[model samples]
Target: MGAAPFPAGILIAAVVFHATVVLSSFPATFHLERGITANYKLKLSKLKERDRVRHGRMLQSSGVGVVDFPVQGTFDPFLVGLYYTRLQLGTPPRDFYVQIDTGSDVLWVSCGSCNGCPVNSGLHIPLNFFDPGSSPTASLISCSDQRCSLGLQSSDSVCSAQNNLCGYNFQYGDGSGTSGYYVSDLLHFDTVLGGSVMNNSSAPIVFGCSALQTGDLTKSDRAVDGIFGFGQQDMSVVSQLASQGISPRAFSHCLKGDDSGGGILVLGEIVEPNIVYTPLVPSQPHYNLNMQSISVNGQTLAIDPSVFGTSSSQGTIIDSGTTLAYLAEAAYDPFISAITSIVSPSVRPYLSKGNHCYLISSRVVLRCGALAFRKFRVKG
Candidate 1:
């Protein structure tokens, strides 16, 4: 049938090939700053690339992670009000919601009935973020600006009677989400190089203006506006940094809660302490090498055929968007048993037929060789 089992010799060869590919790729797991804007073409291509990794019997989910997004500024005490994974463009900062999605690129927000768009809402939707006089010399994204096309696609906007573009839409994520647009006259922040409020007066911050709607929507921010798309896309906030000569491929994030104080996000390199970091090799530009084989508790079980089938070769990806490790059915038993033993036995694991490979206890410890997955607990 399927190419006649590849003959014994060929099958052995395939096994060797499998090991070689992963093993060889292991050494390539570090970020290289190869000059900003220079490697952007390379980054964009990988995001759009179609070939997916298939391992043994499992096909890795075709999800891309956009881990770098600006911490939302909330009208309420920011550190307290900001609970959503994503931020909307139009809703009040304290009430916005966004998905920490790794599946698609582009960060978008929902702007209900927006028009005359610009920054966040793109072009079609409109949002009001300006003084009619437009005395702010900092608003640089004009109808004839090249950045609009470079970051955002283009607008189908015609002039309103006042001869102004009206408002704009900032579309970052996919159809799964939307963000209206607003123009931050400038993007300002405390300098990383020097401790001063550095201002990019000419730079316009275009965001996905969104509204927090109902039904399975992110629960943290019901009164929020929209999400911040951190996925890899040409129009992402990370991608917009090309002007400052920053690399889009090299980025990181740390989400801190009420108790832990906080964490830091390193865009180029990780300079933090005490974090057991896993070095990943970027296969091309934006994509990293996935793992195909796993050994738990010193025992190797037959990988689930459901993962890829006996003949496939894609591997497991370490996703920041996903909070848990996804294992095939073959790998589930030992995976759970090992975790249960280390974590509180009160924790319970779940298997949802064809749905989840296994719903791991909310937080649990997972030990693999020298690497340990801590903060392990179970949610009901």
Candidate 2:
């Protein structure tokens, strides 16, 4: 089967749109911060003001064109997709900056008793822990309650009658994990009305208040208030708002390159005439897409179709939380070989960790129209 072509005149912009948080306002905008690098330092590059705007689109697109909710985001040289939004929590809401992730379901924040929570961040921004006791609107979720059952699976419902506080435990692929209980409180953010005009609104949202963290979550430089999960799970802030009839329960984001300030995140269906819609793989926990072929510079790599087939444990997942792209061994070898065979021998190639790197001190310039993603098309 042939892949559906994108609409004519529709430029598939490099800015990838996604969503991670939901607000009470019809259209809301949050300024994002590029997360700190693993080395605990901020990467700043000086560029011409016109060059910045030329290579990147500003929050001005939030109201018109292909964008709606225009949220400004900072740049992180280390991790390209680490975007966060600053919002308030509690009766008299205190501001917090939390990383936006789409691979998980729960919205969790480090609490006052966080054992491994960081006190400082490399982003040069102040970090604060959530104090549930300080918020009069805050309430503990009990294990016996229906909301607790909503969070747990039928087989995992082992509630303690003696202590009814609903508990949550989450583990990441990087050997990092967090454990804590749940709480409901007022979540506040601004809604974009017209152009930069925003109005404030608040809603009661149930989120995890983590008290313990391990691995990178404990690192002060990488830690923020917590993570805002925007997965498809019903427990996500998006689903919670939709269940309450908040605003049709939809959202989108446009992820910009490092040179750009960041991209827009809107809360509605995007109607792009030039957009091509692909069917998602069903019965999967995460967003999985069917990949048909792989190509580079318009040349399809010589690889078997079975190499891309789904196994019991491995499959194609579209996760924004992931910082890098990894190809299976069968496909990676030929992919690199093809690229190296075409390059000039004058540029010496060396192995750097797991990558084939070239030593180029001279400024090599390519035209704006040059370079393209793999020619492999995706189909059902």
Candidate 3:
């Protein structure tokens, strides 16, 4: 797929935290770092592997109250593509490194009794498990809880007959899955004050304690402790904090593209005057956007508007977990044709393993600019 124009920063909601909060108070922001260190080819290959599985499936508050997390990982899609941050959980605060994904809703970690959880990681990070027995503040969520009811409706959660625990079994499109129960504990983070001073803070959060893993999740090649989803659901960490009035109900992120990968993930809205806004498809399970048309080098492609429409199984979704962009089958041909038509005469375009490959010489100058998308409204 051709490269699309990306905003300097992304804001999920319109209300900026700074404008909403009082002058005496500030909202908390979570800072995240990229964690991948794999080579370019390996990362690209992993992206393809993840894309194959993912195409199948598919915050906040306040205070002079800014929560920031120190992130680790690269932002370059060709290099280390996945970004993760450290979370201190439980009573005594055990550290867990989780991938920051905007595609799913729950925040889960490998538990002490987890079967098939990786003991070590190829990413060079020490793997740790969340042992509920070790944390004094940890408690298992029951099936009767309201959160569990919501989980049952929105996710793969079910009530276990034995002990009446809220158990979840998440199956990905790639055949990988995880089964576990819900656990509530304190999530530790750093609260920034006066834009310079930092203070430690903690909040009660509901998260998964994975007891079993299968498929790619069991592999140590690119493993992490768990996944921290920045989704728009009650079970997500962002919404949990927002319901508690800890921060605004929005989040923003800016991924740095340099080799030394690090970026900012704010639990609150980012105040940017130059940011463009697009309406999200309402009440959808994923972050679906209404894309009306595609433009290549100021020329619009002759693709149907319905190609990007929201339906039960079709829509344009923005997912952070996915490193590569995927076009719908209906728009693929037109997009490729437009891209190829604009290429220089010296450059050669070929097909390799079902992928559109381009061979351009060092001497050739390709003046390709932004691939723009026009957003249109869709009636619910």
TM-score: which candidate is best? 3
The collision pairs in model 2 are 16-255, 17-253, 17-254, 18-253, 27-192, 293-376, 295-375, 295-376
> In every candidate, how many clashes are there?
71, 8, 26
lDDT of 1 by residue, 289-316 (tens): 4444556566654555445322223334
Alpha-carbon RMSD to native, per candidate: 19.2, 14.1, 13.5
The order by descending lDDT is 3, 2, 1
lDDT on C-alpha atoms for all candidate structures: 0.36, 0.63, 0.73
Name the best candidate (by lDDT): 3
Residue 106's lDDT in candidate 1: 46
TM-score of each: 0.44, 0.72, 0.75
Question: What stretches of model 1 exceed 4 Å from their correct place?
Answer: 1-104, 110-176, 179-185, 194-202, 211-215, 218-224, 246-249, 255-261, 271-287, 292-315, 337-380
Q: List the lowest-lDDT window of 10 residues for candidate 2.
A: 367-376
- Alpha carbon deviation, residue 184, candidate 1 (Å): 7.5
Q: After superposition, how far is residue 25 of candidate 1 from its true place, in Å?
A: 43
Candidate 1 vs candidate 3: the TM-score winner is: 3
